[model samples]
Target: MGEDRRKEIKYHLSEEKIDELLREAKDDRRKERLGFLKNLYYGDSIAEAADREGRSAATGGRWADAWNEGGLEGLMPSFGGGRPPKLDEDEQEQLVEMLREGQPWKSQEIRHLLKQEFDVEYHPDYLGKFLRELGLSYAKPRPKRPWRPENPEEILEERVDDALDEDDQPHNKRKGDDEEGWIVDDDICTDGGTVLGFFDASQPQPYDNSRRVWYVDDPHVERPLVKTEDSAVGFYAVNGTSVVQWKETEEKEQICEVLEAVREQNPGKRILLVLDKHGSHICEYTRKRAHQLGIDLVFLPSGSPHLNPIEQVWKYLKWTMAPIIVENEDEFHELVKDVFDQVTQRVSFAKSWCEKFLDFQKFP
Candidate 1:
C-alpha cells in the first residue's frame, strides 16, 4: 500500500455547511463521503481520515482529488463504463406487452427472438434478469384448457359432502330397541378410519424443466446443457401429511399393488383414494382390486388435474430433479429415490402441501 502525500494541503468548509451536508445525505455512501470531508477540514491527515472512514489511503487520495477539482459535487457517485442495454425503450415496451399477453415463453426462445427481431444477443441466464428489470417475472407454465364443468362450485361442494359422508359418525345414540334409529350428525365427521390419499403419475424426461429463474442478458456466458438418455414413470400416493407410498412403473398392475399395500398398512381403515380418471384407474380389474382392498377410488372431474393435491407433489419432484443430469436409467432411479427420501422425511412439509395446495385438512 502507498501512503497519501497530500497532508500539507487542506480542504475547508463552513461548520454550518458541513452540518447541512451531513443532515442532507440520504444514504450511507453519501454520509461516508461527508464524514471524509469533515475529517479533512478538521486538520486530520488523509491516511488517518481514510482509516477513520474504513477506507484505504488510495481511495482517500482519489476523494481528495475530486474535492479539489469539483468540490462536493465531484464526491457524488458516478456509474459508468459498462456495456449499454441491448433493448431500447420501444423494444422494452414491446417485450412488456408480449409478456402481459400471457404467452408462455422459455428464456432461450426469448433470447432467440431478441436476436432475430432486434439484432441483439443475450445469454440465457442474463435474459431472466433483463426481463425482471422490465417488471416481468418468470413462472412455471400452468396447463389450461377450455373444457370445464358448467357448475364447478356445485361439483366441488358435492365432492366435499361425499368425503364427509364417507367418514360420518352418529352423535346421538338410540334407545336399546329393535325399532329405534340413531341420529347422524351432518356437521361432525371423523378422519380416523378414513385416509385421504391423492394419487398421480409422472414420466420425468431428460430435458431440462422450464422454471422461474432470475435472468440477465450477457452473450459471453454459457449455460451447461442438461442431458439424459433414460426416463421413468413415477407412481406416487400422498395423504397430505406424508407420502404413503411411491413406485417407479407404468404398468396398471402396480396401482393394485399400491392399494393392497396401503390396505395392509392401515388394516381396517377405508382408503379414500382421490385420483384423476385415467383409463387404468377406472378399468374393471383395477376397480375390483381396489374394492377388494376396501379402497374407494374417487375420480376427479374431467379435465381437472388441479383438484388433486398429489399433482403438487409431482411438480415438486420435477423441480427437485430439474438440475440433475442423469447419465443413465440407474442414476435417474437412484436420484429419484434420494429426492423422495428427502421429501418424505419432513412430515410437516407434506402436510402443508396438502392443506395449502389441495385444501385437505388434517384431523388431530
Candidate 2:
C-alpha cells in the first residue's frame, strides 16, 4: 500500500501554467525542481524524473508533496534562515553617509574603518554581500571641481537674445537691404552662404583600432600590438553635407589652404568658417587671409567643443577608422584619406552632422 501511494503520487498543472511558473521562477534550484515536475507531467516516473534532474527520488517526492499541499509557492527557495547583519541600522547609515561623500575607498580601507570606528569585522569576500544587502554598491569615484557661475540661466538668456539680435541684422544683407533694415527669411541657406562648414584637425595613429571577437571565459581577450611610430594630421571641413576639402599636415599653412579651397569651390558665396580657438585658427595672419578670401572666421566659445559641430565629425571619423590595421606611415596616410573620402561622399550624412548647429540663434 505504501509503494502504491508513492507510485500514484501526482500533481497536475496545465502546460501553459507550468511554463509560466518556470519563467517566473528566479532561482536555479526552483527551476530545476520545476523541470522535474515538467518531466512528470510528460509521463516520466518520479524516480526517472529525479535521475534526469540529478536528484534523489525522495527529494523529488518531497517536492511533489509540497506542490500538492501549497501549489506553485512550494517550489520557491526560502531565504528565511541566514546569519544576522553585523551592522545595526545606525551603523549602516553612517557607512552610507561616508560612501556618499564620493571619496576614493577600497574594500580594505572600508574594512579597516569599520573595525576602528564601529568595532565591526567582516570577511573580505562577505563584505560585498553585506553592502549589497544594505542596498549599497561599489563604484568608481568621479572627481569634480567646484563650479559656481553667477545667475547662469540669466546669462544664457542674455546670450540668446544677443544672437537673435545679430540674426535680425544678417551679416550678408544686400547693401540696400541693410540700409533699409531688411532681413532674409530663409533658414536653409543664410544670405551669407549656402554651405555652412565646421573645421577641425585630428591625428590618426597607426595603433588606434578596435574590433569585436569571441573568446573563452578563463583567458582574457587581447588585441594585436601595432607600431605607433607613424601618424598623420588631417585638416577637414564638413558643411554637414559633404567634405568641402581636407588637407594633410600639422602645419598652420594647411589651415589657410583649406579655407582657400572652400572659397574657390563656392565662388560668389561667403563662407562662414566656424572653428575652435586653436593657435593656428587665431593667428593674425590666418584671420587676415580668411577675410581676404571672403571667409568669415567665427571662433567657438573657449573650452566648449559642444558648440562646434565639427568635433562630432572628427569623433565619427576616428571611431570608424579605429579597426583598420596599418603597417607603415604611408599606409596610415592612405587609410586616413580613404576613410575621409568615404565619409565625404555621403552628402546627406554630412548635412545631418551640421543640423544641430544650423540654428544661428544657438551660436554665442
Candidate 3:
C-alpha cells in the first residue's frame, strides 16, 4: 500500500465544538471527518485517529490541513455540483442483479461492491438515492410461513358462520401440514358459545434482550432487567371484556383455567375461543376441559399466529413494557399485568379480527 500522506497539525477547535458540529451534521462524510477530529482531540495520533475512523492516515492529514485553514467549514466535503451516477443503464442492471442474489446488503457492502466491480465510489446517502432511482427500497420484511393457510379469512369465516356446517354444530377444527396435521374433530361441542374471544400465551422478556432499537439522539441507555420466570396468557374478548394472568408455565391445565376465566366473563353465552394449536393447547386434556367449560376452541391454521387477535395484545404489552425497569421478578410481573390490563381493555384490539372474520349480523 502507498504511504499515508499525513502531517502533525495543530488543533483549531475545542472537543465540545467538534461534538456540536457532529450533532448538526446531516451528511455522513461530515460526521466521519468530525469523528476523525474527535479521536485526534482526545490525544490520539493522526494515524491512530484516521485508523479509528476507518480512513487512511493520508486522508486524516488532509482533513487536519483543511480544519487548520478553514475551521468547521474546512471539514465539510466539497462534492462537485451536478455529478451524475457513474454506472450506465446496462451496468446499473448488472449491479441490481448482483444485489438480487445477496440476501441482505448494507450500504457499506454495496459501496465496496461498487468500488471493486464498477470502479466507482458513492457516499452512503447518495448510494441510497441511486439505489432508489434503480427501483430498490430498504424496508423491514414481514414474515410469511409456507404452511400458513392460503385462505385464512375464508377458514375463519367458515368456522364462525352457523351456515358453514350442515348440522350447524361447532366442530373441533384441524390444519393439515407436512407433519401429522391439526384436524377438525367432527364430534365437538353441540353449541360452543355465542360470545367470541381469542386466547394466546406469550413471554414478555426484558429490555436488555434487544441488540438495537430506535431511540432519541441523547443518552441511549438501558438498565439491566431483573429477569422473570413468568410468561403471560390473555383472553381478548371481542366485545371488550378481557382477562390476563401471569403463568409459571403455559401448560394444558392453564388453558382450562383461561377458558374458565373467559366463561366467567360472559356466563350465559357459549364462548368461542380462537387460538393457535400449541402443544399445551391441542392435546386431549385441554380439549376435554374446554368442552366441559362450554368453550368452543377454534384452532388457527398451523404457522398462522396472525389469525389470533390475542397475539396483537401480547405484542402491544411487550412494546409498552420494553422501556420499563423493574427491580424484582414480582415487580416485573405486576408491571406486565398492569400494562396488559390497560391495553386489552379497549375492545379496539380485536376490531380488525372482527372485521376480517365475522359478519356480526349472522355470527352472533
What TM-score against the true fold does each predicted structure earn? 0.44, 0.50, 0.57
Instruction: Give candidate 1 regions above 4 Å deviation.
Output: 1-144, 167-192, 206-251, 344-364
Tens-place lDDT per residue, model 1, 289-343, is: 6655666666677787767655666667778766455566556667766776566
Candidate 3 has a TM-score of 0.57
What are the lDDT figures for the candidates, one per model? 0.59, 0.59, 0.71
Give candidate 3 misplaced runs (Cα > 4 Å): 1-126, 140-146, 149-154, 160-170, 173-193, 205-225, 322-328
**Which of candidates 2 and 3 reaches a greater lDDT?**
3
In the predicted model 3, the residue pairs found to clash are 174-182, 174-183, 174-184, 175-182, 193-270, 193-271
Worst 10 residues of 3 by lDDT: 176-185
Candidate closer to the true structure by lDDT (higher is better), 1 or 3: 3
**TM-score computed on alpha carbons, candidate 1:** 0.44
User: What does the lDDT read for residue 70 in candidate 3?
Assistant: 78
RMSD of each: 16.0, 15.2, 16.7
Ranking by lDDT: 3, 1, 2
Worst 10 residues of 1 by lDDT: 170-179
lDDT of 2 at 218: 40
